[model samples]
Target chain A: MIAMPDQPSRKPLVELRNLSKHFGEGQARVDALRDVTLTICSREVVGLLGPSGSGKSTLLNAIGCILEPDQGWMRLDGEVVYENRWLRGNLRRLRLEKIGFIFQTHNLLPFLNCTDNVAVVLHLAGWKKSAAIARAHELLADLPVDHRKVAMPGQLSGGEAQRVAIARALANRPRIILADEPTAALDSVRAGIVMDLLHKLAVEQDAAIIAVTHDEKILGRLDRIYRMVDGALSS
Target chain B: MNLAFRDIRHKLGRFVLTSLGLSMLLGVVVTMAGIYRGQTADALALLQATRADVWIVEAGSHGPFAEASRIPGDTREIVARMDGVSEAGSLTLQTVQLVQGDRRLRLQIIGYEPGRPGGPATLIAGREITSNRYEIIVDRQTGLLPGEALKLGRRTFTVVGLTSGIVTLSGDSVVYLTLADAQQVQFDLAPPAARREQARGAARGSTDLVNAVVARVSANIPASLIAAEISRWKHLSALTAAEQETLLTRTVIERASRQIGLFMTVLTLVSAVIIALIVYTLTLDKTRDIATLKMIGAPDRTIIGLIVQQALLMGVSGFIIGTAFVYAFRGVFPRRIEMLPADIAGLFVVVVLVCLAASALGVRVAVKVDPARALAG
Candidate 1:
């Protein structure tokens, strides 16, 4: 257990109520999620720990609006976003404007340079090429290896690639960042650096973060921890 | 960001190799078109070289190529005396096999009067035939050089001149001979066959027959009028030079033209299949990246555009390279290969359409990629 922060309480930035999801059918069916409920406030770093097939990934996908739950209610920034079914709006737009995702492996496109990978999101958000590129350069300049902005993903080191992925996730300045094992592939030193970066991003940008990870060593630095077993969650 | 170009640059070697392979296929397509054009040109080569205003053949014949139209050889003199006739010559066309050393070569033997219509035009080497006996002018395609001796029937003829682009409607190499020699070659039979025919009580056909009479009309008179006058004789048919060309191309070479059309269709389909396979393979190589893009909130159109743009680039590059390859080696082909500018432009349009169609397969694969897969790893 990690001690909770003593900051003033605020409405949850993201909320899930009675979320249920199942896969396959009959004897092959698996209840990936069972009425899971959770909440994380803005400017908070929450860690989720679970073994393989414990539904951590399923819950992340549901929150990211990529997968639908069999029965669910989801609220973001205290506004109802999903009830019985999703609200009548573009889910893709919602994801682009309100959510960010970082994968276990650095999923930067191998073809584009670091800046381009980051700028592509801004481009999708209707920014002009010059403005998006400027914003990409600004975000990259804040990273430790700003000189790698022009280097392709294949040319970047593991740490540099992860940092570039982080820059891409933050480019749109979404309210929520969903990270699935973002530090699972890093060394101890690089993992610590990444945890610190995520912590700083939550506080400075006022964004809520849910990091689904298997690394117990990094849990000490998070504000809260949730454990999932057999499709149920406990904090 | 231009992701297509970026991806290509990232895998420059693979992209270039694929483009090279595609270009060879495209080169074959280009060469096929050139061959069709060459066929048409070869069909018209002899007619254009004759430059005769009118041609007179036996009645009920559709020119000398489509059917045998032998008229009396003395018809040339009678046509020469007609009004508006500047010069008239007897022309005899026959296919003959000539032997040189151990090689046997098939040639379209054209017999014509010296210093008149129906002879090889524009010599590439040596001089035109000055003698009417056993001297011949051969097209360069016959693989004969000046002063080379070739056997025609029982007699040996010396090659006195070489001509370029002289071929029959069927793309056979042409050799020019005197009307008298062609008549003998056409009418004379082997000794045994002649003896057998005599014992059978069949007199040999007249050797004084010519296939057609060509006339160069005066500048002031229309060749059509002269042709109309010749048709009045009721025993012969006359056609203007344009009519003869039409008769040869549309009638004599009609089957070949259809075969080439079918060949072009097959090549185009093959090119489409090749492009489609290459695009599908390339898409398969990038399925992971495509899934990531989907997860990142990139719209399906963006991914589709990436694929379509790459396909277009490959098509254009292949077309350019193929055109260059064909052009550089055009003359080396045994038959003429004609690549016109208009034809190349048309080919570019066709290649772009093929690429568009080919990219549809990749687009189908990309659009089905599940974005959730990005979270798995």
Candidate 2:
């Protein structure tokens, strides 16, 4: 068991200790993570750097509360959410209220336009439709993508869709944002622009952001960077 | 709700095309159900038009349709003398081919007394059969109008009046005539053969036997009790109005009813499977989007709701279009397609249930999607 992090006067916004994840069983079991520990304070943009097959994505999933780890303690804003193989009651509600996620594929719902895509999370989190749409418009205007707010996923360019996805992630004003390779599909210019937006949103909104990326160009903009190798994080 | 409506609008062409296909399937299903209901209604209409309380036929035989039933014509007088019996009439039923112009039309001839209980209730055109001979009342669906001439055996009869919706169990049109005329047509053999047979049998009689006896009872009398008393007599089977209807449906059209029921069940099952496939395919196309939604903290219930709403929309749209199409084309159907309100309501309930059940496949697939896959490179 890993020692519990000391609870200071103001605790970290997100924490993971001794996290491990293994896929399959017995002979086929492959350990994807091994005793990983990490943290991100509010208003910080932390970058997770690694080569392919590293545990960066595995760590991100554990933080997102999507994959239950084999052994770990996970906390969001000083709350002990997971220990080893179990989660606290109402993890779904917790996810809805506390977490947002962005993926490499710009996985916007094709059926919904940019604005509705962004507003969906707030709607799911029990916001009224008008309020959710208003918030979505505000976020899009902030990102300066409001001109294409009515465009569908198929109608938007790669960078525009990714920005819409980011707007969707911020819809519920979550405490933590988990972005897995958010810039992987864009060109260098577009990638830098998206990373800048992520950094600006993190600092301006006082939200914690952990973006896992293989793109080294955006690494310099991160507040801190951690590299992962062979299922473990390294300084 | 916003997402659901927006998604449907965004994919309007695909949704409408799929709905059209579903509507066609529903149309066939509704038509099948209507046909079955029509069979039941037709059976009831035959009984209702008779205006009789009791039916008497040969013992151990289902009369009017199932088998040949011949009882002495004097049996009507015997039943009229029974307790609670007010009036009785003899009726004969036979299938014959009538020639009109160059066409040969098959008809079920019904013979009844002119002023008795077994006559037609109303005529839609022309006058009722005033002359005892050489005049016939034809079902309007038979395509014969007033003053049309039809040749039956060596006799030419003029169509006096036309009645509606009086087809036989076999779907053949019906022709109603006086007892004397119907007896001649029903017992008419080749003239030489009839003479030779009569000579050989050595039986010449003025009395004409009928296939069955129809009796009207006093409204105060219990028909069941009268039927029971008549059944007590040897060599005769008696049925009340309700029993006669049951016998017609159970014994007369039982095979056709079973066939129609099986067809309806098969169509319903086919409809369910088609809906399931369409929903499953639609969900499969959106697997990645669903995973992303799941990863973004959309609950399982939300995803399930989205899929189910789509299925229900498809079902409702299909049902509305199908109902409209059935009603619009009902008259053009060769056989009657009776669309009753109860049947429509029942089909609506079934369609909703089928939609819910069909959506289960999509819901299962959506729930099983891995949120990790949304992040995978």
Candidate 3:
């Protein structure tokens, strides 16, 4: 696959240039990410397709600031957030305030209900509990799982849990949404539903989303899809 | 914010069961502390009941307890003549065993001059001794009633009074008697023993010698000053009332208290370890959840707070339940179990500290958890 030829007219919402990350040393050394370069424009839904150990997850983690890249120039909303080896500010607070993450397992807090799980980030971002919960209910109402708003994660079905995770990601209205195989555990219908929801959220919220997945069923609906192999990426 | 509570609620049965187990351990700790205090109280009961300001014993003796102290029975007269001394009386202490019907009873026999310091201070039944020769005051624990005949030495004596909460450091019931009667019981020997003692060329000791002389000082004078004056005598050692009390507690009950104290300390430590193990197990069970929390941008404080808060709740609840359990069953114990408000408060503080220390185990595990694991398939 060749890299997408058409460059967006607007500044990319997220950009990673020549990022490199490695594990081990000497003969045992293995590059997990090899000078990976990519950009996601606002409202863009970028799909990362890879098998296990292909480094797509690594790229998502680096962008999410879960792990600092050994070398990279990364930007979010055209602001330099990571350059070389230094971060712009506190990575955790950056992630809390500006990045939203969805996981393959829909890692909703088991003890919390759907509304509470979604409201936690809002509360962390300084919203009052009542207001945050209200916002969470509103987001759930917009999603397909509004009826399960008060249900605990353990009680929700797989698709319903994924819906709650999406609502939680959008709680803070973050600029970047990172999803790692968000629909890998769902049936095709449920996977299509999650993909449609992600696309709808991207267009409506103008938030860039990068989802890593092996499910090619939703690839045609994505704005662009990148295939990763042996720590390298191609479109 | 209250995720810890939510998790606890989710596992309410397990949490409650663990708390109950922890509470039982805490109950033992509390009971041990109470026993230690109760032993101290029992040790000092006789001293406090005497209401004397100073004690005059034989020179180089810790009195009645650590070493034998045989001062002249007439030492009371000498102590009374000292300036600032308001009154003085001879006192004797000895342990005696007696057979009453089929039961064998051991008691601490206290000898005091009638109408003087060293008499039974509180009587719950009957009158104080009227006869200087054959009447005795018995603690209620001895199962003796007024008018009951108690045999000691070669003579049978009638119980004239009953007292409570008086015991020796070894936890024997205390019996009170006239100084002369106690002396006869203490020093008098059987006919055959007397003959043997005479053949051995051992002098028959005077029956008037008492263990110590207890004295009260006038309100204007300090007992320590009079004691200092008495200490100058070549053959006499004088201790202020406080010193005597300290001697009794430190020497008579010191080992017992230390044993109970050690037991309490170990129980507390065991409680902490048990809590740590439980918290660590709970954390291990929720490792993935914790990692997910971290991946969702929860700070280290939030994650640690979840664990520490749960541990603290368990500890505080366990302490309350344990303290309640101790209070409920304290009387069932054979020995006195004294739970003072101050002691209870102190134990609560110790429990809280132990709980926090225990939470450290879980906090370490939680903080070291890799948030990136949440991203793994």
Which prediction has the highest TM-score against the true structure?
Answer: 1
Residue lDDT tens for model 1, B1-377: 78899899999998898889889889988888898889889988988888889999999887887788989989999999999999999999988765667777888989999987877778899998898799999998888998888877778889999999889766789899898888777655335777688679998667788999999999999999999999999999999999988887788677876887788789889888988989999999899899888877888889999999999999999889989999999999766789999999999999999999999999999999888888867
- What DockQ do the predictions score, one after another? 0.69, 0.57, 0.55
Local accuracy by lDDT, each model: 0.88, 0.85, 0.86
Query: Model 1 over residues A77-157: C-alpha lDDT tens digits?
Result: 666889988883677777888888888897899989999999989988889999999989988887665799999898988
- How many angstroms is residue A205 displaced in model 3 relative to the true structure, after the best TM-score fit? 1.3
lDDT of 3 by residue, B18-67 (tens): 88988899998888888888888888887888888998899988777667
Better of 1 and 3 by DockQ: 1
Q: In candidate 2, residue B22 scores what lDDT?
A: 87
Residue B136 CA error for candidate 3 (Å)? 3.1
Candidate ranking under TM-score, highest first, comes to 1, 2, 3
For model 3, the stretches where C-alpha displacement exceeds 4 angstroms are A1-11, B77-84, B98-104, B143-150, B153-160, B187-206, B228-233, B250-272, B340-343
How far is each candidate from the true structure, as Cα RMSD in Å? 3.0, 4.4, 4.0
lDDT of 2 by residue, B326-353 (tens): 8999888877788989989999999999
TM-score of the A-chain for all models: 0.94, 0.92, 0.94
Residue B62, model 1: lDDT of 78
**lDDT tens per residue, model 3, A67-149:** 88898799887678888876565676788878899988888988888999999888667789999988999999998688998
Off by over 4 Å in 2: A1-11, A24-29, B2-5, B58-62, B73-85, B98-104, B189-207, B224-237
Which pairs clash inside model 1?
Answer: none
